[model samples]
Target: MTDPTLGELTVGVEGLALLRLLHADDRGAAQVARAARMAETREVLERLGREPSLRGPLGVELGLREGYARWAATYDGPLRLFSIEEPPVRRRLEAWPVGEVLDAACGTGRHAVRLAGRGHTVIGVDQSAEMLERARAKVPGGRFVEGGLTDLPLPDAAVDAALCALALVHLPDVAPAVAELARVVRPGGRILISDVHPFLVQLGWQAQFPVGDGRAFVRLHRHRVTDYAAAALAAGLVVSGVEEPALTPEAARTPTTELVPEATETAYAGLPGVVIWEFARP
Candidate 1:
């Protein structure tokens, strides 16, 4: 049999690069490559497309370039929608008397733009270049650095206040990142974090199709509220408040709802889809 054509080899190499970026593990990439040989690349790609992470499901087939680019492009829309509606949250943020603010994990610059508009000097940091690109377009005045939560590029005690909105849930261990946030802010500076309630994280979601007796196919990491508080404390931050804001009764009738279903909405109504916590470095 003739050897595979150069185009086929190029495709396979591209697949390998995608696998490497998705897994960030050499052993895992090798295993995925072996599996792809048994199953066609197209089939592999189809499976990964369903997952949130690059390595998720048919991710290998999607290839690194396309998968990463798509993630960067689509991330801004949902983030803006979720953040723009929280007027109370925004109000509290505006109340803080700080000239310099660091919006850590500031996806799409929703909060960053708001803060900048209020005349505060803001620096937005995020790992995804695509997200940062969108954020830059939205808030040209605010400085944006492309980096992870655990390692902020800013100097020590660089900012008067730091805000992390709906971004902690993505990190594997919230402690180190929290510590980094605390370290960057001056003594008595405040840190605000908002994320999905722990209960919501525990209640897993089902796929459209049944997989393994119709059980929840994916289990998201649900870090406890107390644990998060402890992390803040360990990082030398004093917790001031923890609140679960209510969705207005009138706001409920709107066609675009943040709540998923009756049960979920009820649960979220009692417990917030967003939890806001305030901390101060002593």
Candidate 2:
């Protein structure tokens, strides 16, 4: 399939913005906003006519290995998801007794370093060797292994606790990975998981990152609340707690927001950015 053009993206944004404004109780104000959105759409069409090159591809889609390798260099930069996901995950991780903790899909050792610092023996596993290299370098004392989340490198009941953060969304089916986590943790040991909420995925969010002048994205899958609950139960894990932290306006903003700030912000406002799940083996 051909990558969507910039003009196509702009038109879609304008349509969404107008749809968001059409429901205002103040009909007069809504009419004015709709007119502005229409004008913006018209301007994009005119520009595309004048410069046909404006219809060039906006981004390229990449596989997980290639995407993470390209992203590893700038992975430590200010990512909004990390900011929102870290606080809650950290709170729960800190609450656990400091024992061996498995950081599955532990890109760049973001959580492994902290677990190591807190005196827990950290075992970090990830599919991307480039990311694992960064993780190894960042947390020299922690054990970093190159491995997939569905087939962990450790034995059954190997760790006291496990954390799989912001990674489950990448999997098309989360059941195998969930079962793997359940298998690795000892009985009564806890597991913590954080992922992009399925709501956002339904709203067309993908794992996007910058690549030179254009953008690149890795497609994400939607794993609903029930999907997770069913998988955990089937794996003999009980849900201890769940948290759906709403996105801050800043964290919710997307590149398209620049064109329709109010409409875009309104669509995402008060929406949960990530879902955190805490499970325990009985």
Candidate 3:
């Protein structure tokens, strides 16, 4: 019952037992170590814009929320994706007129703290209370509320601006969440939504986390650029700007294989790492 992802890693004979142990729901050191290695390797693959295997727990016991419940504990730690995404989000925020802010799917207050620190009245919303607890601690002034993207617990046209960062990938479709985002922001207010680039998600990169001893992969939808545009159009949110920010100039052009394999570096070097949408309610 080894995780299907291990087939890609081929972690060697010593890792077979580890994989089996993880498959059996045993979170022992061997399993944990192997899972961590796999996750790191997957991250490297994802960075190179290759599709990483997304296999993990598969059943009701392994719901996305449950996995995040475990992932919430370390949601704000040092990870490549965080570093890759945070800067672009910050840069995008600079162009917007900020006031009351909504941090939809605000995990661990990572971006919320920064936005709040910039003097925006930030309200962080997430499904995981465990994640919200850390968010609350990170930005005491920012309101932390437990909610999902599909049904946000907020008044209509309530906020001046909104942000849904790297979260729409979890949804089966972007429309529901986009509608919610549109519903909350006042007319003329801006909404900045960032996500794993459609190209990367189409390449099979998954939303996952190393939780407890085993790994947890939340189900994700592969959304294209058109899907986002359609959702916004249908919701009546006017598109103001679309940004496809790449990795830092040095890293994107370096052609280095220190982290990723040579083939992947060749394939994806200098490519856009994330997709950002700036929309306004008219």
Question: After superposition, which runs of candidate 1 have C-alpha atoms over 4 Å from their true positions?
Answer: 1-72, 79-85, 205-220, 246-269
Residue 245 lDDT in candidate 3: 72
Tens-digit lDDT string for candidate 2 (1-282):
777776676677677668777887899998998888788778877888876656776668899999999999888885667778889889988889889999999998888998998999999999999999999998888888889989999999999999999999999999999999999999989999999999889867788889998788888997797888888999999999999999777787776667557656655766789999999988
Inter-residue clash pairs, candidate 1: 47-57, 47-58, 48-57, 48-58, 48-59
Error of 2 at 264 (Å): 3.0
Candidate 2 structure lDDT? 0.86
What TM-score goes with each of the models?
A: 0.64, 0.89, 0.74
Candidate 1 lDDT over 40-70, as tens digits, reads 4454345445633333231122222233344
RMSD values for the candidates in order, in angstroms, are 15.1, 2.4, 11.5
Segments of candidate 2 deviating more than 4 angstroms: 18-39, 51-54
Which residue pairs overlap in candidate 2's backbone? none
Best lDDT goes to which candidate?
2
lDDT of 3 by residue, 21-76 (tens): 45444457545656655665555445434433333322222566776788787766
lDDT of 3 at 155: 97
